[model samples]
Target: MKPEDIQIGKLVRKTETSSPLVECFDMKTNTCPIYMCCGLKGALSQAVGAFYGALDRYTLEDVITSENRAMLQHILLRSKLQPAAGDQDEVPDLMQGVP
Candidate 1:
């Protein structure tokens, strides 16, 4: 999905300006007890890491702009294609059709 399709919440906090760290929480509430142990958290952590890593390297005037948003999206997409920690050879081809 394009970045425009997603909604970014308020700035929760900023650790630094030069290498700024911003945190946003999903407004949607999920009451699932297993959330803490879920794969979703791991994936999100990876995505957030990649996003901040990019911010550290580039000086973006407007992060929500189409260009910047696309860059972030690309980072997320690339992260998904990578093999999970210590599971290089066992990684499944995500492009394959599921039966």
Candidate 2:
């Protein structure tokens, strides 16, 4: 699908990340006594808007390139096979970075 066809902001609208950039942004749920006077909320709101705007500009098509997908699969597989952080040296290089 085209990037603009995807609305990530709408998809995540009910999540905490949708508007809780600062407690002051959500009046109904905000418990902070000084929320009315908090100037930081405006800046944070703008920042969050920009964040969602950026996310909404792209689709999964923009992120999951084959090369990157293969790399991610390799990393996930490597994690499953490795013993522990300290035993990383003993882990085999499975697929030699291929998936």
Candidate 3:
């Protein structure tokens, strides 16, 4: 089948193309625009690259991993224990310590 015939977000095996394809996301447009006709291999590589880039930039605190999820949950649960009696320190005095 031709690349134009395929819908966006549909993944196909790499062997079925005449040329390579490149995967790209247009953030300003808020759409993923894939260029076809480069062959399935190149397209697949681009898709893989995009995926890895996202995964790499995503932090553990973003709750991407099980450990992160558990840690966040624990923080939430612990926060409910008690309120501070005195005036709490507004900000950390980071300048007082060595980096």
Candidate 4:
């Protein structure tokens, strides 16, 4: 399937700014606040890293390797959607930068 064809939760009619981060709505439940719910985070991060690396004219062999792509796929598979019960709480860990 194409990248766009891959359903990472819902597209969320509202599109945020261009970056590694993307905001999506949980169609399964509407009461949930705006939170990160997509499976494309790892892949998106790698892509951004690559773009910046290229723009800076860096010649690193491992930057765009197949292993990096596989890592992204793994992250997507491991991330499961578990709804939040009770009040809307903020998760500070989600704000951490990519390693």
Q: Write the per-residue lDDT of candidate 4 for residues 1-99, one digit (tens) a residue.
A: 234232222212112222223333233444425345645655766875665555444222224356575675566447733323342432222112223
TM-score against native, each model = 0.30, 0.51, 0.28, 0.24
The better-scoring model by TM-score among 1 and 3 is 1
- Compared with the true structure, the alpha-carbon lDDT of candidate 4 equals 0.38
lDDT per model, in order? Answer: 0.41, 0.57, 0.37, 0.38
Candidate 1 C-alpha error for residue 51, in Å: 0.6
Please provide the root mean square deviation of candidate 3 (C-alpha atoms, Å). Answer: 20.1
Candidate achieving the largest lDDT: 2
lDDT of 2: 0.57
Error of 4 at 5 (Å): 42
Q: Who wins the TM-score comparison? A: 2
lDDT of 3 by residue, 1-99 (tens): 322232222222121233224323323343343333335555667776686566555432332255454564556455532223342423222112111
By TM-score, is 1 or 2 better?
2
Model 1 residue pairs with clashes: none
lDDT of 1 by residue, 4-97 (tens): 2222221111312222222222324455666656666666778877766655543222344555655755664576544444543443332232
**Candidate 4 residue pairs that clash:** none
Q: What is the lDDT of candidate 1?
A: 0.41
By lDDT rank, best first, the candidates go: 2, 1, 4, 3
Model 3 misplaced stretches (Cα beyond 4 Å): 1-38, 64-99
Q: Candidates sorted by TM-score, descending order?
A: 2, 1, 3, 4
Error of 1 at 31 (Å): 4.0
RMSD of each: 15.9, 11.4, 20.1, 16.0
